[model samples]
Target: MAYVINDDCIACGSCLDECPTEAIAEGDIYTIDADACTDCGTCADVCPTDAIHPA
Candidate 1:
């Protein structure tokens, strides 16, 4: 499964840099592109507010 960015996202850009596949996009709360996500969990690991999770 891909990782999903929840509403708790602060849009701090922390996960953006951590995504190896560049699946994350900038937005009001940020968004993870399911098709591009590698399910590596890197984004979730770097999320400051624990917003990213398996979808």
Candidate 2:
């Protein structure tokens, strides 16, 4: 399964650079493109708010 960004996201932009596939998109809450996500968990590790998780 792909990783998902939840409402807990603080829009910190921390996950963007950490995403190897560049699946993350900028927004008020930010979002992850499921099609591009590889479930690497890299983005989730860098999320300061612990917002990203398994889908």
Candidate 3:
């Protein structure tokens, strides 16, 4: 499974740099590219809003 960014995302850009595979994309709520996500959970670790979870 891949990590998904939920509506709780604040677009703080915290997860973007943390993703080892560069799966995250900037947007109103931010999005994780499931195809590129490596399921490393690094993004979730740094998310201030705890918006990232397994999908």
Candidate 4:
């Protein structure tokens, strides 16, 4: 499963650099491309707000 970024995301762009597959996209809360996500959990681990979770 892919990781989903919740509304708690601060749009800090921290997760962007952590995504190896370039699955994350910048936005008001940021978004993860489920097709590209590897489920590596790197984004979640680096998220300061812990907004990323498995979907």
Candidate 5:
């Protein structure tokens, strides 16, 4: 399972650095690249808005 950024995302960059695979990318709301995401949930732990979730 990969993690995804939800609409609740505030466009913060916290998750970007937390992603070990560098899967999170800047966007209208940050996005997690499913192919690169490893279900580590690092981004979720670092998310200020709790917007990162399993997809």
Candidate 6:
């Protein structure tokens, strides 16, 4: 499974650097590219707003 960035994201960029697979990208609210996500859940760990979730 891949992780998705929810609309609650505040673009704090915590998850972007936390992703080991570099699947998360910066955007208006940040986005996770499922193709590259390894489902390691690293990004979700550091998300202060808890916007990253399983997809």
Best-matching candidate per TM-score: 4
TM-score of 5: 0.93
The C-alpha RMSD in Å for every predicted model, in order, reads: 0.5, 0.5, 0.5, 0.5, 0.7, 0.7
Summarize candidate 2's per-residue lDDT along 1-55 as a digit string, tens digits: 9999999999989998999899999999999899999999999888888899999
The digit string of per-residue lDDT tens for model 5 on 1-55 reads 8988889999978887777889888988888889988999888998889998888
| Clash pairs, model 4 backbone | none
Q: Write one digit per residue (lDDT tens) for candidate 3, span 1-46.
A: 9899999999999888888888999999999898999899999999
- Give the whole-model CA lDDT for all candidates, comma-separated: 0.91, 0.92, 0.93, 0.94, 0.87, 0.89
For candidate 6, write residues 1-55 as lDDT tens digits. 9999999999998887778888888889999999999999988889899888999
TM-scores, all models, native as reference: 0.95, 0.96, 0.96, 0.97, 0.93, 0.92
Alpha carbon lDDT at 3, candidate 1: 90
- When 1 and 3 are scored with TM-score, the better candidate is 3
Clashes of 6: 0
- Candidate 4 runs further than 4 Å off: none
Name the TM-score of candidate 3.
0.96
For residues 1-55, write the lDDT of model 1, one tens digit per residue.
Answer: 9999899999999888889899988989899899999899999988889999999
Off by over 4 Å in 6: none
Any runs in candidate 5 off by more than 4 Å, and if so which? none
Error of 1 at 22 (Å): 0.6
Model 4 C-alpha lDDT versus the unseen true structure: 0.94
Candidate 5: 10-residue stretch with minimal lDDT: 12-21
Best by lDDT: 4
